[model samples]
Target: MKSRLNVVFTCFLLLPSMVFAEAQSRPRAVDDFFANREILATVYFTVGSAQLNRAGEQVLDKLVPEIEQLDPDVHLVRIEGVHPRKDHDRMTELAMLRAKTILEYLHHRLTVPVDLTLTGSSPSPEVRRAGRSQHRADIVVYDNLFDPHTADTNEALSR
Candidate 1:
């Protein structure tokens, strides 16, 4: 009876800590960028041009209200330029510009300032073969303001 009483007491002590740990605000899957990010829009650009075309603007126009609905302080934004690597230098330069252009567009449109990260990378071989899919900017949003994959989270997890 004493051993059983000790077991119940130990469980009572452990339960609250487990509940609090489960309530941690950090994203459940820290390293999963695709799982963590909310894809707001995938706007495409003309070949060699970072400028927003008619369809791009229309897509962005639809995006504005959705973004405005979120509190800028709690949400994070990122623009990823999906340019597949080519033998020439133009694609790299063009990709970064495409990401920046989308961010700039967001900066001008959002009523409140949003935390934005601009990134550009060559798409995977599969995406590279998708033709028009390469010259694109993906607008991603996250509920967490800071990056979950940052060293801060990794360090905490290690402990």
Candidate 2:
């Protein structure tokens, strides 16, 4: 009788976790998060500047609306900066700064909080050429429409 009672008590305690695990394993929300990945905005900068130009500002302005619509808790944002220069280090630094500038502007303009990350890359040619593509940052937003029925059980279980 005592053993049976203990088993019953254990099951009662484990029920919630078991249910949570099942929900997390369903993967519909995860699928949507992955499926909705694309670059939403691309902001360009001038040579030797980490600041936003008029065109960059205009582009970011349009991006604000898209950012506002995302669920803060469910989405992921990545700003990838690409700057090309003769000096690799200089280009990488500029790229990273440009990305940060974009991130700050978006955060300032929107109430939606996001999981944002910054990445920088530099493609430098030994001799300078007309490569305007070097000074640009791509802002990617993942439209993670979460499944309300399923919680983030994987994280809970790991904890």
lDDT of 2 by residue, 46-148 (tens): 8778888888888988888887776656676778777765346566667778888998887888766666777675433431265447778889876545533
> Each candidate's TM vs. the true structure?
0.65, 0.58
User: Ten-residue segment with the worst summed lDDT in candidate 1?
Assistant: 12-21
Model 2 bad stretches (over 4 Å): 1-36, 85-87, 123-132, 143-159
The sequence of per-residue lDDT tens digits that candidate 1 reaches over residues 1-159 is 978954653454344334445655545444343356778899988877899998988888889888778765457777877666744446755776898788888788878666777766666555666665888999888655253454367644653
Shift of residue 76 alpha carbon in model 1, Å = 2.0
Candidate 1 achieves a global lDDT of 0.69
lDDT of each: 0.69, 0.69
* Candidate 2, run of 10 with poorest lDDT: 122-131
lDDT, residue 19, model 2: 43
